[model samples]
Target chain A: MTIEIIIQAIISGLLMGFIYALIAAGLSLIFGLMGIVNFAHGEHLMLSMFSSFWLWTLLGLDPIISIPITMLILAISGILTHYLLIRYILKAKMIVQICATFGLSVFLRSLAQFLWTPDFRNVGNPLLEGRLEIAGIFIGQPQFYASLVCLLSFLLLYLFVNKSETGLALQATAQDRKAAETLGINSNKMFALGWALGLSCVSIAGTMMSNFFFIFPDVGVHFALFAFVAVALGGFGSIIGCLIAGIIIGLVESLGGLLIDPSYKLLYVFLIYLIVVIYRPQGLFGR
Target chain B: MNNNLQKAKLEPVWHTNKFIFALIFFLVTLFFFFPFINPSNFQLHLMIMIFMYAVMAQSWNVIAGFSGQISLGHVIFFGIGGYTSSFFYVEYGITPWIGIFIGILFSSLVAIAIGIPMLRLTGHYFAIATLLIGFSFQIIFQRWDLIGAASGLWIPLNWDNPWLTLQFHESKIPYYYIFLIFFLLSYFSIWIIYRSKIGFKLRAIRDDPQAASSLGIPVAKYKIIAFVISAIIMSPMGSLFAQYILVIEPERMFDIEISIIVLLIAVMGGVGNVWGPLIGTIILIPLSEYTRIFFGGTGGSVDLIIYGILIMLICIFRPSGLISFFPKKILERKKFL
Candidate 1:
């Protein structure tokens, strides 16, 4: 392949990877804190996308303007989800925990379909509409902004988790719930906060994606699948790992699509996932 | 722990019990006569769907429930079975009756290939791996033009010959009977495994793989065995599903939703048990159907919403399954009293 084509693919892939990392970081955080894989995580993303779509369509708000609103809405829903459904199943069997989230996913997807219908919706004349040409390469404004927002949020989340006291307390809770509780860090509240933060990340991703992609109940499925792979590949419960893995997946997917057939892009991602899972079950950055 | 283990081992075999015998007899008779009861075509179709799903769920339960290896990609085998059988019939003009066996073989081989590596991962990792595998299958099948690509393959219509092509024209009765037979075969195989030494080995591994391995259970081998058996039983359902629907698309055949639904049914009924899938299918199919009929318009997702709610509630309140609602004395026959 020409150097130009390779550069173009890498640029786009890295941008896509940032978005994947944002989504997967939330998933990894929740799993790290609660030890529960939220099967409905995709649904949460879908809901955010739908919310963005609605805000743009009904209220004539740009997706960029709707980002905060989407994040707030999804964060609350995430907290509510933990309280209403996840809390009850915390002590249940592994299968039960899985079923709870899986069921929630089905419920949310169906609810979206019921309320909004299955028709694909998109933001009309999004703020970032044109493509920017740089060095004989073109980048869609939406994609560039999405990647920028994703990187900024990733930085904020990293700072919040690593630098802030509350983030340390959250980490303590994730490390050892009982020990954290004994230290006067309410593990339950921490768990809820983790969910809120995690979902808010997804909300940002949805809002950014709404600028360029079609919004539908099932839109979350493919992205969610990629996020899952990213989380697993990066190592469960590791945010930095998720970011690195997400970028790797994005690169592989984009490059694979360009080099091989675009239709088999997912196949390439899955192949990499399988290889990582089989060879290094602990994941690239997992403890 | 030893006492409980002994008690588990000492659980009574109820095959000779009059109630058990009567129940088996009644079910067999019902299976035979249900098609002839003159139910509406819609009802028959529903029954076929229920039976097909139950078989699939039961197969899934063998690995997930009994062996404690949660596989979210069981639909991969099902899809393989469907595609294999369909390809055999379409390309070679072979009867599906024989093609079904080849499909089962193909599915078992694929299952083993997946299970050997995947079964090593515990719990959620395994689940995620399987889920990815299913998605990969979908993508591969969608792009593979040999299998008719995204549009999928339709079994040619043959009204004159019901026995050869496995097509019954407009009648749903034959499909119902075929699915029923497949369901019974799956149930009986599961029942045998549950009672056999293999079932105990699987349960042992499920409870504690380290302990089971220490006890010389050959843990990995047995898990593979369980996985293969599960895939073998599941393949026929896919084959029959292709015949019943007369249309097989990669997306529909290898849909992650199919895997989720089967897992839900098995878990909802009672995982790792012989009757769990059947009980689950009995409840879910009709529930989904009724919801679809009543809420035909205005965005028809009522059934899924309800199904989702029921799953969450069940997981929270009764994680063991709906079967747990029954008296332990009757279901378990522990100490016979």
Candidate 2:
């Protein structure tokens, strides 16, 4: 392969990976702390994408400008999800949680299909509105903006976790819920916060993705699958792991496409998933 | 402590002996008389489809329901079976009767290959591993042009040779009976497994894997066995599905929706029991038929919405399934001692 093509692929892959990281961060946090495998995570992302799409189409708001509104709406949805569905089952078996989330996923996916009719929807006014030629390689505006947005979101998340009191409380809850409760932190509130924050990441991803790709009902399923791969590759429950894993997966996808048909790229990437699953079940960066 | 609460909440039930016998007799009669009652080609076609899915669901239940290894990608076995048998039958004029055995062998091989690596993964990890396998199969099956690639192979029209097992006489009776046999076989196989010691071990593992392992149960071996058995049962479904439909395509067999349908059936019927799938099929098959009738060829995804809502409601309140709603005595007695 030409060095220029390789460089271009790497850059695009890195950008794609960053967006993946944003999509996955929330899932990792929820899984890490509450042990609730939110199978509907992809649905939430899809929901936000639709929200952003309509916002741009109807009101002429930019995707970035629509983020706060999406976050507010998603935050409420997350809290309601926690209270209405997840809270009662907190003490139930893990299988219950999995089943519940699976049901929720189906519900959300169906709802999307019902409303959107399986047609692909896109955001108005391209996020970047142009492409850049760098070192004899072309880069799209959306890809660069999406990557930068993803990076900034991660930094903000790191700061939220490391600097903020609520973030510390969340970490404590993740480490040990009962212990966190013993320290006078309300674990339930923390869970609510975690859900909101996790979904907020999805909202960010939704906005960014709607700018680049068409939004379909099953869009979340694809992203959620990749997010899980990212989570596994990065190590479950690790933000930094998700970041690195996303990039690795992007490279795998991009490079695999170069080697073979793009449609068959999942074959090679899933092989990596199988190898990692067998050899390092804890993930590459899982502690 | 938690066990005590669970036990209290889930009081077991026992069915009357006469009721159990009557139900079995009714099912047998229903299977035998189904073709006579509705000799129309469409009804038979729907019945065959239901029986095919019933087998698929029953097979999945062996691992996901009974053993508590929820594989969202159980379609791999179905796909393998469909591809193997269809390829052989279409390419070599080999009857699906012979092709079924070959499908079984390949599916079993795939089970062992996947099981050894995946036996260690529990819960979400296990689910993802199976999902990956499903994706891998789709890619492989789609790329392999020898098997007809994405467009898939079309069986040559051969209505003249009935003994060859490749003939189509335009009557659905043969298919209906074949699928009835498939259902009966799957149901009987599950029943046999339910009564066996391995079934007990599976139940124990399903309830608590670590404790089962601590009790000296070969958790991995039993899991592999359960998965392999499940695969064996599903392989024939594929063969029958292809033979009846007169077509075999990768997407038709290996789609994520296929896996989801299995989950829906197993979940709707109730997981971890023999009768769970039957209950699921009884409810879902009719609903599916109705949806198609109402939607009429091309609407939107109204059926998916209805199906999704039904699944969601069941999961929300009755995650144990319709079986949980049975009278206490009946449920306990039928659950297998």
Model number with the top lDDT: 1
Model 1: pairs clashing at backbone N, Cα or C within 3 Å: none
lDDT per residue (tens digit) for residues B244-312 in model 2 = 677777888789888887888888888887888878887887777778788775544566667777776
lDDT of candidate model 2 versus the reference: 0.82
Per-prediction interface RMSD in Å: 1.0, 2.0
User: How many backbone overlaps does candidate 1 show?
Assistant: 0
Residue A107 of model 1 has an lDDT of: 95
Model 1 chain B: which ten-residue window has the lowest total lDDT? B328-337
| Best candidate (score: DockQ) | 1
Fraction of the native A-B contacts that model 1 recovers: 0.96
Candidate 2 residue runs with Cα over 4 Å from true position? B1-18, B166-169, B334-337
Q: Which pairs clash in the backbone of model 2?
A: B13-B328, B13-B329, B13-B332, B14-B329, B14-B330, B15-B330
Q: Give the TM-score of candidate 2.
A: 0.94
